[model samples]
Target: MAFRPAQYAALLLGALTLSACARSPAENPQERSVIQNEDPFVAAMDEATNAAAAADRSARKTPSKPQQSDAPRVDTTAPKLSPAELRQRILRLTAGLQSAADTEAERVSRFLGVSFTPELMSIREGESIGDLEQVGSYRVSVSRIDRTAPGKHVRISFGPAGFSTGRPSICTFELAEFADALRSQGYDAGEVHLPHREQWGFVRYVSASDLTFYVSAELYRANDGTRSGKLCLADVTADAVKGRQ
Candidate 1:
């Protein structure tokens, strides 16, 4: 029996629906084509998108070589001051001492060219300079031009004095002189003092500039008359004075 046109058309539509439902996922050419064309659509989205992705990759990548930081730099090669300028700087630093004793001390210290904080002077008188246990003794003198334009004299006795004879003398001096004296003597020194007091420590002199120097001495003692000492010298300059002050 021959099918009518309407029946044949209906049968054809049913067959198409059944085939579509039963088709394997791999056989879906339209779906596969959509996936295959996806890359082109993404690439054509915009020129900026590709450029931005490249830039991102570049930013995330590390440089094979070391890179310099954008920090401030110091200029270490500037011309230094002349001798005259250095002398002026020294004079400016020493100008503040008004006492005759202080002036002489400062002048001599400057002549030694040693940088120091300040002279700590202590003196004591006892039955014997050695009677004080753990004390040290040394002689110090200074010469300077006075306000009256005359040469002035200043002298000091340095070392550990008997507490009973006088108060313990303590003062801070410049580190430059202390270091210089140590270096001159071929002795290595550190900024820190020894944990225990030393006896007979003496600083002869330190050179700071052509005209400057620093000198110092220290003495340590025990209750049983045991004594030890230390000495320091330093060169004082404008920079040293500024740093200390």
Candidate 2:
């Protein structure tokens, strides 16, 4: 199918409509013709999606001040060092990923389980990239903040049913497995609760230096009764995660 964000929004809206009884096909030929013609509902959704896309584009285009860092830059072109020191430097530099160099192209292809171009992706200050991805029956969205800074953050979320029921599919298990992978990478992992209204699925939070991660099931419900339980993860700098006083 075409990579139409409007269509995707429409399908999501369709799920909500599907939850309730749809109009009977035998209602009338006129009703069928109306359905075949332009749908006001779908058009509204398309407009909303387009507005959001434009806003995102504008945000990315508006330049932001460069990040200020207190830590010294890593010596990638360093003199020879002992094995232990070299490993330590590697860990520090990648405390949360030291760089994100993708810009120019509004869209780029990268592997995050499945190979797909990021149509709804944002790269800001040439330092961070954030995007939402739909992988088969799953939806994955992630953000890596402050790449060039010594202490950056990466957030990832994996959800089942990117295009179907709100209930989780096979991707539920993948959520936990991905958390395990983070643990294997030496992150401090734990489960955390979201606000009361958002407490609908599994949620895990991980922290490592400048990076903090959140893994949880999607907890979005459409007013029309469409529900979803997609897994999601987020890794971010501590400062970014912190609230302003």
Candidate 3:
């Protein structure tokens, strides 16, 4: 408290001189470490750490062999078929089915109660089929045993009548495609309009042949291009075709 400013400055210089005189030992090149502390355990840990780092940096990596998997990776993704492409395949399939049913009589015989693509179309005795025209996807299948008929073996023996099962199917065909498919087998389904079916699902493809197809396989661009198509294969007897409707 009684020290002068000049005396305080001299005391500070003396303390600094004493501190400078107390020198640290000259460091050994091998003992040099990043840690500058006096704690031997800490200094040893620092040396160990530096040694480990240097060893890690200089170590030759074995390039770890990619862990062998039981199964090799494969890209199983398949390209999706477009509507037009799908229509072509369906046409080919229809043609194949037609070829299977070789004779005209066979086509006429199996016309009412048979389907090529059974998943998209099939039937049994007394099983109801949906009529999209009359009841908005309402189905009324061929009665293999109809009590109303004389023999109870057929449904309709008259005008243009066929089957409809507009069940959502992966396989689909355009009106023209189906027409062309049928046409390939001598049946000529008349001009197919763009919007093949009416609002009530009534298709206007009328052909004068033993078997005619009125299938609504149009792709609705509004949705995911899913085709709820109606396949109507009519058997027009000579009497029915010759203005007998």
Candidate 4:
């Protein structure tokens, strides 16, 4: 029997629709498992996770301790100068004074009636260098001379002098000016110098040696540049000189 063309077309369309309907809506469990386990993308993802964990571990590593710096230590020892040692220093200093006087005998004779001598001078312990007070005013003090000079040019202690309460402003005056000022104030004064940061000045006073006088002064420059002068007055004697009177 001969088939009709319209019936054949309808029959093919129906078959195509049926075939599409019959197709599975879900994938096979075994096949999907194989794809997930075997795919390079999955393997690469696992490798990336492991690499991240390793990097985290590396970042969490403990740091090393810092090294300590090397620096110099400061010295804090007080100087040791005993009575004997100080006496020796005084002897040496007096000898220098005698030599200086001998070198300028004529000048010494004119300025001071007597020359320098060793037996006429000595150093005694008076007080430690510290603060000073005078006329109800406080000052930083160093040392005090209990004796007097033996000649015109004397070796005076320069290491010990104290600062006045009114510091720097009063201290900046020239040594000569200071000496002049002290003299004006009725204090025996002389040439002044900074022997060792401590202010020291030379003073001249009447001596027992008949028409002779000794010269020595000790002064201190305060941190503020102010100065304090201490004059030592003595009478020059031929055999034994009178100490500070």
Best by TM-score: 2
lDDT of 1 by residue, 100-176 (tens): 33334445445423322322332111111111122233232443212232223333333344532333433123334
RMSD of each: 38.4, 17.7, 37.8, 44.5
After TM-score superposition, what is the CA distance of residue 97 in candidate 2 from its true location, in Å?
A: 2.7
Model 3 Cα displacement at 128 (Å)? 6.2
Please identify which of the two predictions, 3 or 4, would achieve the higher lDDT against the true structure. Answer: 4
- Angstrom error of the Cα, residue 100, model 3: value is 19
lDDT by residue for model 4 over 6-33, one digit each (tens)?
4323323443354354322227777655
Rank all candidate structures by their TM-score, best first, as comma-separated numbers: 2, 3, 4, 1
User: Which residue window of length 10 is worst by lDDT in model 2?
Assistant: 236-245
lDDT of each: 0.32, 0.33, 0.31, 0.32
TM-score of 4: 0.20
Ranked by TM-score, the better of candidates 1 and 2 is: 2
Model 3 spans with C-alpha error above 4 angstroms: 1-125, 128-140, 143-171, 191-245
lDDT of 3 by residue, 1-245 (tens): 12133432332344335435433433774444433455576566668888988888766464556667775433222224433443343343334322213222224224332222112222233322322222122222222222221111122111112222233332232344455665665443332232233211111212333322222222221212446344432211110111111
TM-score of each: 0.18, 0.28, 0.22, 0.20
The local lDDT score (0 to 100) that residue 41 gets in candidate 4 is 70
Clashing pairs in 3: 129-139, 129-140, 129-141, 130-138, 130-139, 130-140, 131-138, 131-139, 132-137
Off by over 4 Å in 2: 1-96, 99-158, 162-166, 197-245
